[model samples]
Target: MNLRTFTAVLFALTLPAPPAVAEVGLSPFAGFRMSSSVDIETAGASADDQIHFRDSPSQGLALNFDLAEPGKQGELYFSRQSTSARLDNGLFAPGIESIDLTIYQLQFGGLYFPGGKSYGGFVSGVLGVTRLEPEDSRYDSHHRAALSLGGGYQFFLTEQLRLRLDLRGVYTALNSGGSVFCSGGCELRFRSDGYLQVEAGAGFVMRF
Candidate 1:
């Protein structure tokens, strides 16, 4: 983890225990996002190409506030993933040209347990923005409106501690009005308006 993320986790983990109702909870997770592909048409290219993001490890933190109803909570979630992007059909030789990419997601939404608190099966949905950053200046960072749906099981380890296992599908809506491209040698443009990612995470939640 980076300095900022490490600090936040440490601070959250050291908080004092809360009342019996569990007003709030902090969750620190380690996860990975699945690979994704985007159809692209670059200038000076004879035909269409594809930009692909390889599967990579992801890390994030979640803040949850318990609602008046049992097994219901509102959440603020954030996640980050760093990976490599490559052009399927390009001027460079095969497996030669690669770009470093990072994605950050921030969202707000709700979590619910359908069966009951003891059942542990939960569902969640969040709305937010996904920011894409390219280490190469040839392409500037861009943001897109996004949403995610998730399902998981929560296991209580103690009165104030629990384990969370989650799987999520994240979708981003892209508009042609804006674009993320390279001006130097390669120009990249998306052919579609939808981008999707699947992720799995495991973490410990501290209730307070």
Candidate 2:
């Protein structure tokens, strides 16, 4: 080979390699929710009532796309809980009796790892809306701004799968004096700060 051709080939080989292709992870998780409740003031009643939601099971799925940065991923999260709610007040109220409710959280967010490892711990934050739906035909669904702060560690089980244990503190916004689940027959007025709940979940993350 000619000297010039050899030198050109050598320079091309010395160039740095490109970054590795990113990965995607899908996780279907199941867990429990704690301390879910809301305070309400009935429209035509003198006393305020508390609606207490029972602690129940929650299941969800999360889809994550790896970013250009190592250990960073964009996440789409969704969760649902079907449970019952009862009145805390002793007096009989006309509206919202023996309420069976379904709650959902749909969010978009990201996760960050300080250690920058796939098998290590990471923190996540999600911003979205909390949807509270009643089984009763008279009441309509309610949607409110919500957020969650969470973190967890992933345990490596195989090259294609890992186990993740996660915990999150969720907050749903309830602006004071806002009416919810309103229809001609029954309505509820919210009072107090907001609604707060905690979740603990474990799931398998499949990577591709």
Candidate 3:
């Protein structure tokens, strides 16, 4: 080759290639969640009531972004659960009024799959905020810090589609204090506490 042609070829070879695009995935899921009942205690008083919350169904969606290393990902998710509550102590009359409670959560976490591709097990840890909303306007809503740890398996149906089965244990702290269930001078004061809730579900994931 001539001198000019050789230099041109060298320059072309030296040019950097385009940056690789990151992989992203989205998963939407629906499943059942069973929560442990919380015992309400009055501060510096013996009077108390146990709030029994029923098991209810839950649903949520998660977004995943692949990291530089294979099998590692960052995720953002949201979930909601609805259920009814009953007071064990006769503090409130039975069927006096219906109380409906809804729990909402917003989370961010990381997941690591043993195998780089689909059809493997993955572990995850998430930190988020949980909000409790009551149907009765008389009672106030609460928001607290929450954490979740779990693992699951993903089965790839195709190159871009997968199914996931997951089970996680969630813990939330309830430090927001107020008059929860009270009547007349027989008012009950609540303190800060925490509770553990378990969740299991399946989801359909789409990779891009």
TM-score of each predicted structure versus truth: 0.83, 0.83, 0.80
lDDT (C-alpha) at residue 119 in model 2: 62
**lDDT of model 3 at position 142:** 74
Which residue runs of candidate 2 sit more than 4 Å off their true CA positions? Answer: 1-22, 90-96
- Identify the superior model by lDDT, candidate 1 or candidate 3: 1
Task: Give one digit per residue, the lDDT tens place, for model 3 in 1-208.
Answer: 9999999999999999865553887899998998776766665666666777688899999899888888899989799999876766744433444468788989999889988754479998999999888776555677789999999999878767789899999898876465554433425444547778899999988888
Best by lDDT: 2
Model 1: how far residue 164 lies from native, Å: 0.1
- Candidate 3: residue 144 Cα off by (Å): 0.7
Q: What is the Cα root-mean-square deviation between model 3 and the actual structure?
A: 5.3
lDDT of 2 by residue, 113-155 (tens): 7877666799999999999898886667888999999999889
True-vs-predicted CA distance for residue 52, candidate 2, Å: 0.7
Of candidate 2, the 10-residue stretch with the lowest lDDT total is 89-98
Q: Where does candidate 1 stray beyond 4 Å?
A: 1-19, 43-46, 91-96, 184-186
lDDT of 1 at 84: 81
